[model samples]
Target: MAVTSAETARPLALVTGASSGIGYELARLFAQDGYDLLIAADQPAIVEAKQSLEGLGVQVTALQLDLSKVEAVDELYAAAAGRPIDALAANAGHGLGHAFLDQDWNDIMHVVNTNITGTIRLLYKVGAEMRTRGRGKILLTGSIAGLMPGSFQAVYNGTKAFVDSFSFALRNELKDTDVSVTVLMPGPVDTEFFERADMLDTSVGQSKDKSDPADVAKTGYEAMKRGDGDVVAGLKNKLQAAMAAVTPQTALAEMHRGMAEPGSGKN
Candidate 1:
């Protein structure tokens, strides 16, 4: 496909964690919508994905960035290089599960760095730029797990709670501006996320019946376009989130056991 004039003339979307999962799918959808793209991920697959996107006739720039480094957040903005970022999709993150205090502190901090601090910094930078330009959309990948306490996945859940909560508050803050913030809350996505998190031995990791990343990304894209504050990706997740609201934290934690510990129980 030739680059559409509509695409060639406008600022493009910048998608983080774009090598795979919902990020990759969102990048494809954004390209389809005639947006040129800047896709970044620490994984090598990001390079491959960039080449593939270029074949679709949209201009694309790729970067290998590890958000956990903290400095990478500013470096990403530097890579933007004064281009108006029409859209920002901050979808790069990982999960950390197990008894909270039993886990390595380094692992815990890395998770916090990637999911919380790095994300907030990126949001602050790009969002401020968007506000000055008076227009932009932001999609934050949160998790339905954030709705309640998570036992084995305690720290990961805490991070999502922050993201999901922060997204809504930020949306309200940006309401007067041309910027809109949307949070994509998905559960049990069929991404390589679990394996990458070293959670391949768990039940959530082993589940074959996970939601497709493409579908989840579509939901996010639609929600971001609509300027919705938060969207739970699947119906089952919506129900789960709803239930978590009324259910006690203790009960919710117990219910979350199976999904968190895939290889945990007796057959």
Candidate 2:
């Protein structure tokens, strides 16, 4: 697709995974804050999201592309050829809930590529630009799952761990620059994540106390705007993160098993 010039004078924010859930909320916040948007998701539903965001009186360009491929990340960046992105929310992720060995190799690779490979590629490209310009803010959606070993959701958790670690490293490296990189470690939120990960039968998925996607997004957006290094979304998640810091890995893994192991809810 050809890159288009920004149609408005507002700042531009590039948000991935913006078709729904937290990504959708982040895009809305940006619009509310007066930034025009470039939003992408693997599904065509992103077009509908674009329509809704346009209602907020900001120009929006929606792209439908799977971010699991390197080319797709390149295409997403190319699509913003003429605009200086004031913010980037790399919220795209994939999850597979089951025994790691039981998952398909293809599925595992997609999760890695989407969550780690593609995310880093886009960040490198956009981040380099931001560095040269001496300004920008980045929000990476990590997870509280990253703090533990997700028993049934192993690969998903591992990828988030990489994201969480990478965001902090990047933040430190860019500390002297005006660009800020912040990771948002949110606990379970009411989103399609559980359904798509095939975790609907698990205790965590079935729990009624999941965090609200809007609330999670608001927390991350506020932190990003403030240039904070990282923010864990909820009070419960904050406690979990604090505890995970002192807990042993074996115990954390076992604790995750109770909530995420297959058929955990049934048990």
Candidate 3:
């Protein structure tokens, strides 16, 4: 992480998974709005991300670490060194594709840890402090994918299901407080997500049509600022989320399989 002054004169916003994709875009919004940044990601590419954010002229500190570990979250909080956080974008998450039975246990566990455990841990740590401060905003990057049962991408989607549900629960819990929790449930966006999840060969992955990460981030950022409980990133995704509420799980699972099944894109 780049060294900055112990305390930034500007507001501070911490964004995770910020090396690329929606996370990076969210960080840009913060920088543009004159907030100093603390960005973290599991990859070394975060160092480069910091360099780019520096061009935005606000103090930027980047931490490269695996947020899936509880200790890492603690370390991240420690790095903040008592600085007040004005906004938190808890967006670090991973996904796994293919049949659950065939997936490696380690991969499945990683998905659960990164998507669920790490997210809650960060939220709790930051949220507690924010509650005391009486002001803060939180944006959690959940997924429209969570609305349906992912047949081939079982573990990943299951974890997101937890996130989607947890977001609302947390929001309700914080309703009386000044701190706000908003969930961004986006469908597919053109990011490294499909490749990282090893779903590049799937139909959904191959589709040229997908939401732009910048647009999705903007939607979430705006919703968070307004203290809205949640925002689905696209009209199609909003419809999907609505449908999921009434659709039977068994049918949804089959529908997901048609898009995510191995080599489904090749057909």
Candidate 4:
């Protein structure tokens, strides 16, 4: 999409995985705050998101791109068309369930590529430009799950661990510059995450007490605006994060097993 006449006046935010859930909520928040949006997702729902966000009176460009591939990430950056990006919410990621050995190898690789490889590559691309300009904000959607050793959801948690760690490292690297990096670590959230990961039969997946995506988005967005290094979304998650620091790795894995092991919801 061509840059609109308003693009010069309004700051732009690129939000990935924006077709639904936290990504969509983040995009909505940006629109509400007067940011033109370039939002992407791997599915057709992105088209619907653009239509909905346009109601807020901002130029919304939607792309359906699989961020798991290197080429797709490049295409997304090119879509910016050399326009300055004021903020980037690299929130595109998904999970996989079941034992690592039991899960399909392709699915595992896809999860890693989406959650870690693509995320890091996009950050590198946009973050460099932001550093050169000396101003920008970046928010990465990490997970409280990263704090623990996931038994049934090992690969997904491992990827988030990388995100949670990488965000802080990058933030420090840019400390001398105006570019800000913040990681949003949220616990179980009410989204299609469980269903998509085929974890609906797990305890955490079936629980009704998941954090609302809007609230999570707000927590992350506000922290990004403030240039905070990190923000864990909810009180429960905050407590969990605090405890995880002291929790034994074996115990944490056991806890995850109780919540994520297939059919644990039936207990």
Candidate 5:
């Protein structure tokens, strides 16, 4: 009697990284679409974000999680016992600047843990559940940067590369099922992500002239609702994606050097 099954009339969505930026906007968009939300992010801001979603008339659950920790994935799914998630948006990600060689081991591990290990683990479990139910939608937050190379932000871009690639493969594998996987590949967004990631001083991070997270999230959600395999959020980023197809890998890395370098002003 306690659990709300997936057969319910109202859709329920679980969004990671809902504390701010694109993740926060996705929760709002889903709420407007009448989906109840289970939002998770490591930051304290999830409290405010959840309150905002509740104000939109959606049932909201917020959790503070260090998603970088491997154990957090199961805990997140367990927390959803009473709710059958119709959709899962894996939108939490972070960036780090400075030369990869010079970066702290722990910091790099933290990013890798969250972006790679943790994300894939959750996706696997959630995908399995959806497969059994024969219904569900999943969205992974990827980046246009995944197409090319990242200089100082190498690890971040590499992780996104994994996400985008993994999403495509998973989508194909589930082609026979009702479950759909969408990879939201967005360019820069005007959010506090850069500030918090400590990349605000870099050229790419300092680029305040970025896409709105709300707009980006809208594109992703709509695409997921339609079961589109992938979507690039901005026009400029779309062009970047096009170039990535033809450009040489070495050339792309060189191009990214100035942007990721410190004092480059990409925020």
Candidate 6:
């Protein structure tokens, strides 16, 4: 971990998956607000993100580590060096496209470990610390996909469902304290996610109109600051989430198939 400074009076925020997309944007918002950042991602791009954020005149510590592994999560927490983590943006996750059974076993587990296991583990560690101090903020990046039964993107959706539900449960458990937890559930966004998830051949992936990541990050960041339980990023996504509440499970799965099935973009 390369830190820009030793320590300071500024509040510290730890943001995971900060290499790019929503995570990077969230870190940028924190920097602009005078928060020092401890940012992590599995890719070398985290280093680049550090340089970019430093231009905002905030100290940034960048760690390149795969959060799916338990050791990595511990390393990230330890990097705090006993300094209080005022906020934690637990945004690290992985996505996979195609039918569940058709996907490789390793790839499937990678998504599970990254999106569910690692996220919860880090939350547990950080949440405990926050509880002890009686203060902190946590923002989780869930998805609208979690509300429905994903057809081709089964494992990814399952992981997000866990995230969305877990965040609410944890928030209620900590309500008496000043600690706050917020979940950001967004629809498709204009990011590298579609390409990385291998969903480019699907209709949802190929669509021209996707929410801007910066905008999505802003929604999440503001909701976190306000201590909201959860927020759906876009109007279209909010309507979809509202409908999922009344729609039958089988119908939701079938609808998802049309959007995420392999090569559905050509239809």
Q: How accurate is candidate 3 locally (lDDT)?
A: 0.92
What does each candidate score in C-alpha RMSD? Answer: 3.1, 1.1, 1.2, 1.0, 2.2, 1.1
- Per-residue accuracy of model 1 over 1-267 as CA lDDT, tens digit each: 222234247568989999999999999999988889888888999989999888888888888888988788878777766678899999988788777877899999988989999899999999998999999999999999789887778889999999999999999988899899999999989988887666777777777778999999999999999988889998988888889999988888887776675466332
RMSD from true fold, candidate 3: 1.2
The 10-residue segment of model 2 with minimum total lDDT is: 1-10
Q: Tell me, by TM-score, which candidate is best.
A: 4
TM-score of each: 0.94, 0.98, 0.97, 0.98, 0.95, 0.98
Off by more than 4 A, model 2: 1-3, 6-8
lDDT score, candidate 2, position 153: 93
Model 6 lDDT tens row, 1-267: 633346588999999999999999999999999999999999899989999999999889999999989999999988888888899999999889999989999999889999998999999999999999989999999999999999999999999999999999999999999999999999999989989999999999999989999999999999999999999999999999999999999999999999999999999
Residue-level lDDT tens digits of model 3 in 1-267? 433546557999999999999999999999999999999999989999999999999988899989889999888877777888889999999989899999999988988999999999999999999999999999999999889899999998899889989999998988899999999999999999999999999999899989999999999999999999999998988898999899999999999999999999999
Off by over 4 Å in 5: 1-8
**Candidate 5 structure quality by residue, lDDT tens digits, 88-118:** 9999887877889989999998888899888
Shift in Å, residue 235, candidate 4: 0.6
Off by over 4 Å in 1: 1-8
Question: For residues 17-107, what per-residue lDDT tens digits would candidate 2 score against the true structure?
Answer: 9999999999999999999888999978998999999999988889999999999999999888768998999999988999999999999
- Predicted model with the maximum lDDT: 4
Clashing pairs in 1: 202-262, 203-261, 203-262
lDDT ranking of the models: 4, 6, 2, 3, 5, 1
Cα lDDT listed for each candidate: 0.87, 0.94, 0.92, 0.96, 0.88, 0.94
Clashing residue pairs found in predicted model 4: none
